[model samples]
Target: MKRTTLSIALLSTVMLLTGCGEESNQTSNTATTQSVEKEPAQKACYDVGETTSFERKDVTGPRCQWRSEHNFIVYSEDLSKPEYPGTLPVKPGYAVRRAKEWPREDLSDASSYDKPRIQFWWNNVSSRDPLVNDYENGYKIWSVKIDGTDLRLVTDDMPSTASPQTFMMSRSPNNRYVAYAYSYGEPLIKAIFDLKTQQTIQLGSARTKPYLVWADDSSYIYFSDGFKRYKYTLATGIKEEVDVPLSENTVIVDGKLINAAGLGVGVYDAKTLKRLYTILPEKEFEDSVDIEKRIYRQIAISPNGKYVWGINSYRKVLINVEDKTWLAFSKEGDEKKVYDKVVNISNNGRETQVGAAIITIKHYGSDYRYELTGKGRQSWKVIQSGQNTITPVLYNADANDGRFLEIENDE
Candidate 1:
């Protein structure tokens, strides 16, 4: 009886060991399945037959779409080469622009002494009606030598009737040419002035302001004609419509023209005009109590193309480019603070001096006061300031100088 009992116990132990081996095998097979599922799929460089659209990697849905029918062609920056084929010849002296009446000594004191000079009709003094009165009193475009030696009036004919409306000035990306836009009357005119030959080609009648952008110095010129964006070749006289509407306040970077569009921001191939991706606005802030209560006034793109500075009716916000994160500038009494407006981002973006005037607000009361307060940098020194019924109370502040450019009525 004892022998039979011992044999039964041994058989039971063998069965238990066999069951444990099967369980171990099942766990190993389950782990292998999970490891295969966790691996990410490889992505292709280029997708075939893909429609041009902007897709924010952080957001869902087709946020923005571009039609090829709208004279939109996408150029790959990789494929687009410089216009001037050979090595660019170095010029000895720098280019400069100054007023003819201004002394060469005074020109040296101007802030833009180092930059190549191009002339614009500007008032000698900051006034309430600088544009209206100054241009009518015989102000014309001028060019100044870089060394502050020569100053010559570019346009011989000064308008006797109305002020010449100067819109914008830009040097070509390749530094081959200089372009400016001016409005004579109803129709706007753009002139591409060739510095090499000292000749000007008047490209007439644009719907809105003509934005002259360059892919390179000698090869191509990009402009938006209100309806569409066009690239004109100086050598071949070939003008082609691109595949997407170029965004406002766009800059060429990494072979792509990134634009600030209505929906969000988009990146397009500067050569092929193909839309790469659209960065969508953060949705979390859409439902915020503060943002919803106040009206958003202006948005400024940083010079370095890293952050976006936006001013609302109530407050200011800074947005990060890479992470789609935002921080709002808040002011309470004499103390100023910056808080995270959007989630998932640390409040670490720094403020810099913005060149252009983004927006202006007016307050009319006994408590009316303009105060410039930020963490690190102060306001820019005011170039000019004045107050009138027509003009908003001008309080110009410069980042370099800590003084206010305050204008009080002599009346």
Candidate 2:
């Protein structure tokens, strides 16, 4: 459905109603109760039929890493590979327009950000990109609210002709700037899209693989071309070199420099560049299996700073820093099934910053939800049953209706 695209000023400005006189405290309370009762509930996600609901493994308590059929799916996207070759929309520019109340429109290939409040993905059959296999011609970045409202184009035509590839794409923590890398020439073209200004600018080019990180302030960004680290300010258009020996895969999550490697996950203080946390591999598991042989991938920290997950091909470990507990399933060690998985932690609302971590795992054409018990234990339960259903708030923004990017090949 189409969004009521109000300007930033209009949306940000709070409307204050004036009256002849103020109401009494009791009357105000009554009015407030009525307003609260009458307000509409937050939108919920419904099945697009393309996705399904699967099983959830209840492997929680003392042990760690569910090394058997208890493994759940983990949904994640690689920023390095932004555009994947896929089928275009049949109608191309035809977007379904709807009011605030919506029907289950086909959100086939839609992909959502970690936040899930908004979704952004490239549209191949868009009116902007009318050519076939002419991916380089131009494409549009379509965005919509989680409730399927406020559907609008976030970026103008991103021409592949100018940028042979638009890789390493990410939205800023503030959601103020959207950055990506493209091939302009010998140097890699790195561009930023200002959501407020609705303008896209080529900050400059890099010689490296083009890994970018936005500062918490959103005023500056740090990126690595290869081994060289540089910072660019959005307001001043100034780029400065930082003498930090960082690599291309370095990412800034919640303002921390996250380095996920063979050593496990390392969370660093982005400003002082000090190591804040060095999450090592579980020693018990390390002793049982070969470090080089066992796979440890998709290392992510909960946004609430409560849990850290080391999603392995065979085993998965959940860590709570306060208690120093490495929790997982009941079983351990062995060749599990072909695990196509990506686990995400979210809140009740798509845009809420603080709340219980709604731990979701997608595997085998279905989804399962688990909760962290009050004692910091994992409480596994089937939140939804049936086909591939999403967390009602996520509007699929990709071409392949709700298809996730996960490969079980642990190498």
lDDT of each: 0.41, 0.42
- Model 2, position 313, has a per-residue lDDT of 46
For each candidate, C-alpha RMSD in Å? 29.2, 22.9
The reply for model 2, stretches above 4 Å from the true place, is 1-115, 126-137, 147-149, 160-167, 184-187, 243-258, 301-307, 321-324, 329-340, 347-411
- Tell me, by TM-score, which candidate is best: 2
Residue by residue across 1-411, what tens digits does model 2's lDDT show?
Answer: 135556544555543212212345668888889887865642322221122334423222222222223122222222122231121111011121111122222223233342144333432222232222344224434444322223344564466444434335555655567676666457777788886676787766656676666665567887766557778887788888886534323455465676555546567777878888776755567778777645565544433334455555456655554345565532243322112233332321111111111222222211112321121121121111111112111222222222222222211
TM-score versus the correct structure, for each prediction: 0.46, 0.49
* Candidate 2 accuracy as lDDT: 0.42
Error of 2 at 269 (Å): 2.6
